[model samples]
Target: MKQVEIISGGPELLDIVEPLWAKLNEYHKKRSTHFSHKFEQLTFEKRKQNLLKEACDVTINLIVDQTNNAYVGYCICTVNKEKQGEIDSLFIENEYRKYGLGAELINRSITWLENYQAQTIVIGVSEGNEHALDFYQKFGFYKRRYILERE
Candidate 1:
């Protein structure tokens, strides 16, 4: 086990995010939990680039494993100036799952939101992602509303 460090997103960090995005997307697909899997058009690069750009105003935290210089996971949060904050996305590399990385990322996101004076945090997970739902709920997150979708 290596010392894990939490840091803000930076240019040098895209390398980590790009691979993590691919791994996470693959994980979701293999589990048949990717909401857009049917479309088969969600480009990982586009999403990674968008998230990197979005980091300018939003809070994105990465957990890096010092021993191997690998990005174990990341948590993204967006703060509304006057409303609750949003946990945009969170994913831990499958191999790194059980080492408290996900929780640490969530903790950092909450800290960032609190700094912005947000009292509550909101997160939306697709219905098919049972692991995510369970993870968030384990941290005391309750389902606030059902997001309905129509094909």
Candidate 2:
């Protein structure tokens, strides 16, 4: 068995997560036709800046393989002044999917938000991703809104 560590940090951690982040963007693009944002348009420096801005209001957690010092998953969550919490992103490497790491990431994010007194928590699932929807549903999340869009 391997030991997994969860570390919390701000955008400065992006340097360690960049490769996995790129893979995450690609994964999203491949999963949805509407996910047409040209991630390539942003240079890494700009992306890091954007992440820094986002981190100002959110908590970012990274799951690492302690032995090899590699990041294998991440979760980002934010709690608003209204006491509402939003899970901005969560992803785990494909090879790591079956080991419950994603669930652990989510559990930690939820606990962090609850500690801040969040009254409600929400997670957005891409329209066509049933697996993600089901995953969140398992945690007692239910549909609250429909964001229909046309290209």
Candidate 3:
């Protein structure tokens, strides 16, 4: 198996990132899915550009690829001076799940935050995302708070 490499995201990667983001969004939109209604309030285009901008400067958006250069996953890390650093978003293709890409992304984000002298790192997972919660807990993250909304 080829090692997964991390690359800086930029205009060159928009073509790839946009499609991946869309797919993830679609997955999140499926009402029957665990990710549904969790991120529906967010706008895809605006969020994508914001993430891209963050990568261009202070924050880091890591694009993971195979040694063969095929893209596999990505994560966005943002430093919040008022709080701990934040993992803005993370996504790995369905075919790539259970392969440790998610854990690698979290580790890389934590390293980036520490390098920037951040006090800690924070990530938000939906209430029903047991898999995600488990993944984060495996890395020492705990539920700090709960967010509820009436729909």
Candidate 4:
């Protein structure tokens, strides 16, 4: 097994992180059909810009394979003026799933937010992603609200 290193940085690392972000978006689109329509409305450049914007506001952490210097996963987190932390995105490549990388990413995000004096931290799990929800729950995150949509 290759060693995985988590590196913390900002939007300056966007180029290296964009591919993972794209994969995450695709994953979500597949898990929830509703997201497909919203995804289709945005051009690639627009999507990239939106991702860049999100990355700019938060701490971006990349999980890399030290042996081969490959980017395999990423997490985005930010703290608001209200002292609340939001984990905007997190994704790990399929090959890396069972290795505790996701938990490490979440721990780093929580630590970063806590450093900012965040009183609460929230991660948004897609409605149908029970695996992700269960993963976060292991770290004490629970359902606090629901979002209903209509079109």
> RMSD, each candidate, Å?
3.0, 2.5, 3.6, 2.4
lDDT tens string, model 2, 23-72? 76676667776654644354556756654554435788998888888888
lDDT of 3 at 58: 40
**In angstroms, what RMSD does candidate 1 have relative to the true structure?**
3.0
Clashing residue pairs for model 3: none
Query: Candidate 4, residues 61-139: lDDT per residue as tens digits?
Result: 9999998999999987876566778888788999998898889998888888878878888888874466777789988
Q: Relative to the true structure, how large is the alpha-carbon lDDT of every model?
A: 0.71, 0.75, 0.67, 0.78
Local lDDT at 31 for model 2: 71
Which residue pairs show collisions in model 4?
Answer: none
Off by over 4 Å in 2: 37-56
| TM-score, candidate number 4 | 0.86
Task: Tell me each candidate's TM-score.
Answer: 0.78, 0.82, 0.75, 0.86
Candidate 1 residue runs with Cα over 4 Å from true position: 10-15, 33-39, 48-56, 81-84
Global lDDT of model 2: 0.75
Model 1 weakest lDDT span, ten residues long = 32-41
